[model samples]
Target: MDIDFIRGARLDDHLTIKTYISEFKKASLTFAQEIVDQEGVTIAKALVKVACIDNVKMKPRPFLRLS
Candidate 1:
């Protein structure tokens, strides 16, 4: 899936947001670990939009998460 993000922006997508948010959290954890390995705790924020592709039979909306 592809993603786009901006600060303080509202998202319209509805479906697949939960799973996408989980995956995004994992990825972010990895990144944070990379940084924390060298330094102490660091503050960071993230905004992500993931594409949710659904078949023609079902309607799907994209997913967005901010953390």
Candidate 2:
């Protein structure tokens, strides 16, 4: 996961977080995310990657079908 802090949030600030898929692969997924204040000011951004793995075999595995 890689994160960049654009601005600091104050104690009284109400924050909202949003995320979406940026890329998809057979065994991995990448995500784009952001944190914003009540007024829609961006406070931070992140790029996160996650992988599907077979724990028993200790190897990569394909993601399950959504539908």
Candidate 3:
């Protein structure tokens, strides 16, 4: 995970978080995320990578497709 802080959020600030997939692989995904204030000013951004795994087999697995 990597994050860059563009601005600090104050205690009274109303913040919104948005996230979306930036890359999709056979068994993993990379996500892009951002934090913004009520007025739509970006305060932070992040990139996160996550792997899909089969719990029973303890191995990498392809992500399920939703209808």
Highest TM-score model number: 2
Model 3: ten consecutive residues of lowest lDDT:
7-16
Q: Where does candidate 2 have its weakest 10-residue lDDT segment?
A: 7-16
lDDT tens string, model 2, 1-67? 9999999998988999999999999999999999999999999999999999999998999999977
RMSD of 2: 1.0
Kindly indicate the candidate among 2 and 3 with the higher TM-score. 2
- For each candidate, what TM-score against the reference? 0.22, 0.91, 0.82
RMSD values for the candidates in order, in angstroms, are 14.7, 1.0, 1.5
Model 1 per-residue lDDT tens digits across residues 1-67? 2333322222542222222243443223211111111123322233344445455845544444568
- Candidate 1 off by > 4 Å: 1-37, 55-67
lDDT of each: 0.32, 0.97, 0.97
Error of 1 at 1 (Å): 13
Model 2 segments beyond 4 Å from truth?
none
Q: How much is 56 displaced in model 1, in angstroms?
A: 6.7
